[model samples]
Target: MSFRMIAQERPGNPWFSWDYVQGNSDTILAALREHAALTAQAVLIATVVAIPLAVLAYWVRPLTGPILALSGALYTIPSLALFAFIAPYLGTGTSTVLVGLVVYALLLIIRNTLAGLNQVPPEVRDAARGMGYGRLAQLLRIELPLALPGILTGVRLATVSTVALTTVGVLVGHGGLGQLILGGFRNNFFRAEIMTGTLLCVLLALVLDLLLAGAERLLTPWSRRRAEAG
Candidate 1:
């Protein structure tokens, strides 16, 4: 084969390439947007579902064991296996991945929520009661606010976890950046493509975690003040 043919046949697959990034900017951005959207949706739904369940488990002590067990069990399931199991019923799309992500998130959020609620000092509850705060009022105004930090911690963890797990959604054609990673492997181990996807996933997780941390600081300014005082 001529030199030109040989070069064309075995194109370079550099580990990092700004040229490749510029060429595929649209595709990369689209995948990133989808990844962010899926992670946010999954975490939001999980939080909504988890808070109520945590409250219910908190009040009805007997139900706590079962609820925690079920969520923990769901978390224990392998991500790929869980996706495969759901795909048969959900038909392999964003829905399947969303459901799986929500399932995976429940354990952390629920556990943290319950922990936060339980951490509310008995004296604090008594003080609220002394102020004529009804059960519902105390829970909403005092307990939930006090628990916000812990709940946000759980959310932060779940968000990071979901970002990584979202890549698994590629099995269902909704893997977002995962598509690039898989494509890289399939297309003769294109390092740039693989690195782009991998690095983006890591960056997304870091950015989300930092944002949540900032939110926690904003929402629980007292905690920051207390830390400074201590």
Candidate 2:
């Protein structure tokens, strides 16, 4: 059958009519919302879990080697296998997707968070101590502030990676922009729908990266001011 004939409105299947177009658009919107929600949830959970572990590892020194090794191993699990392994417990949906994403994000965020924290100059820490700043005070007022830019940079990277991986959820029956690409493939429609999904994902990543970059600059106004001065 011709493309038009195949895509054209049929009597009983609701996908063809103008009403269906509007509804499908709504469905896509809902899917996008779900995708964002799951991705964010995973990232936030992973960030909370990983950053502290990273901080502790950095502080402990003895545990650093083991922790890094563990994270690296987790990172090696192929996305598809990770999702499939979780399928029995989490089943097919956002939960499994979130779990896989959280695992994937841990190594990245933790490493970045550690690097950002460690980047604070030792002299600065000594100065803070000399000025009677306690550990908590030093971390809150000095170290974390200095680290914020790099932490935000890691977040931007994590978000973009999650967005791309969410597309893979289609394989395990989760829906998102991936559904668009899957539908296109199943229908043998070359690249039209696939391209649409790909472009949307890329654009979403770019926008997220820009927003995170802005947040970094906003949070580090002193750096920006110093740059202006120089």
Candidate 3:
């Protein structure tokens, strides 16, 4: 009648156990691996799309309003609601999640990209033009380099958001850390399930932030010099 009774039936089998996902070695490893893959895929796709759109928005100021508005709308939708809304049309799989992640990533990426470009002094652009550099050349060589720090900051935010939102993908039957939380919620073992999922998610995000920070340092060595100078 109760979960304990159900759990007793499968004694020592944590996977089939009543309280948790049985944390049996295989099940736990599988969940961890699945979550990592999904999160990586979603983040990778979002970065690809966001970087181009962000760069485009930076180059063409007029597009900023529309580009930002679209991303803003995506950000406004609650994660679960967004997944549910798209699941019908997209049919509940990784594709739907990818679309959602990209939409959410655009706002942060665009803003940061534009901000970073803006931070590049007007004189620099003028000097580049004063030289033989073409518009595309200046953008590729100068603008992107100068904007790296801000872009990385945007990436940091986007990464955190992606990790959080990916959890909701579970509602669509997609597995991630969200699956863990959802399973826990469904079973009503609030602490074990919720705690495990939440902690893992937090840890994942923090690790990503650290990695990105290290990457920013590696990619933007000039930024470190600038910091030292100031």
Candidate with maximal lDDT: 1
* Per-residue lDDT of candidate 1, residues 36-59 (tens digit): 999999999999999999999998
Per-residue lDDT of 103-220 in model 2, one digit per residue for the tens?
9888888888888998999999999999999987888898888887767777778888988888788867775778776876686453455555566667877887788888888888
Q: Using TM-score as the measure, which candidate wins?
A: 1
Off by over 4 Å in 1: 1-11
Candidate 1 has an lDDT of 0.93
Cα lDDT, model 2, residue 205: 74
The residue ranges of model 3 lying beyond 4 angstroms of the native Cα positions read: 1-23, 188-190
Model 1 residue 203 CA deviation in Å: 0.3
Model 2: what TM-score?
Answer: 0.86
Worst 10 residues of 2 by lDDT: 9-18
Clashes of each: 0, 0, 2
lDDT of 3 by residue, 109-185 (tens): 77887788889999999999999899889988988888889888988888888888777778777757787778866
